[model samples]
Target: MLKHALLSLLLLITIHTSNAATPKGPLEILRHSLVQEVFAFGIRPQDTNWFDIEVSTNLTDWSRLATALSTNATAFFVDDSATNAPTRFYRLRIPGTTVAQQQAIWTELRRRTYTIQVERISSSGKYLSADVTVTSGAKHISNVKDPLTGEAVADFDPADFPSIEEIFTKLEAAAQTGIYDLRVWYDPKHGYPTRMIQREISGMNSNVTELRFNLVER
Candidate 1:
């Protein structure tokens, strides 16, 4: 009787240890913003191919916002609608998998980039305003263009305003012709740029421009 009891105890211990070591993908919230009011979470791609983003005001009740697929690595989600409410909660649920969701994830990850809100005044007393959005490593300028003999119209990076060094070179040139003022704001998490202001102060023709980058989804 004593030998049988010892064997059963050993078996239970082994089973419990094995279960504890089993790999199960989990989701974790990395960062969040209240003023921007965005919440972010990362989900590792596991046996399931698709996951659902469920948002809730209270933890007990959740509303499904989006169904997304995963690549080989972890995937990120940013909830911008959090800005509208006083408080919000989010979670990632592995409901099911689908081929369409897989394709959509690829497309979304490809298109996810940055947007720039540009406002500028030229030395000639002319004002140029525009929005620039970067998609798939290309920049689409909304309102402004280059008038110089040879200069880039726009640039893009996953992080900040594309070609920041090039922009500084232009700013210095503008200052040489007149006066230049530059200001920048950076996201604390990644140390990437978020907002900027550049002013050309050469006299009455001085042009002031502002550019705000969308650091993340919000």
Candidate 2:
């Protein structure tokens, strides 16, 4: 009887240690903004191809918002353009995973990169809201040609390509010359394009021109 009890105690100790080493999964709140909300959690990479995320004010009740996997997932919320709220909470649930894996996932997310730029139309109408000036790159323009017609492209007036004092001068110039806006926000670490906004110039019409760009580019 004494030997049996001693063996049982040792076995229990081993089991407890093993359990402690495993990870756990639980809800995580990523960000809260007036315009946007973000939440995320971990799911086993093997068990499910995607995660089912639910949001609710009260923990007892929930509503599905998004479904995604460990690598391909975006769990976020946005209020209607007209209506904005103050505070919100989010929750996540996944099977066959522990909370620790979820926490590790969040840590990985923090390493993602972000870039923000705010542009406004200037009070003056003659110039663009923002200007980008560019200098000649290492490769000079041998001869400008219209890619569409295979005809020699006319040189833009000096006013069209202003001198840039900073790195963004080239970008600003490109914007002014009606090249693809090419404005992009990216996460270099993951090689993911987070957001992009572009405008295409249709042609001169009275005083107004038209443009286009993708806000979300995968």
Best by TM-score: 1
Clashes of 1: 0
Q: Pick the candidate with the highest lDDT.
A: 1
RMSD of 2: 21.4
Off by over 4 Å in 1: 1-25, 45-48, 97-218
In lDDT terms, how accurate is model 1? 0.44
**Tens digits of per-residue lDDT for model 1, 1-218:** 53432232220000111144563535443333333445444545353334445566656776655544433254545555555655555555544323333334434443356655554443445333445676655666554444343344454332223433334344334334432334344443333334445544345665655554443354
Which 10 residues in a row give candidate 2 its minimum summed lDDT? 9-18
What is the Cα-based lDDT of residue 57 in candidate 1?
A: 63
Those runs of model 2 whose alpha carbons end farther than 4 Å from true positions after fitting are: 1-30, 36-48, 72-87, 96-218
Residue 193 Cα positional deviation in candidate 2, in Å, after optimal superposition? 24
Error of 1 at 210 (Å): 24
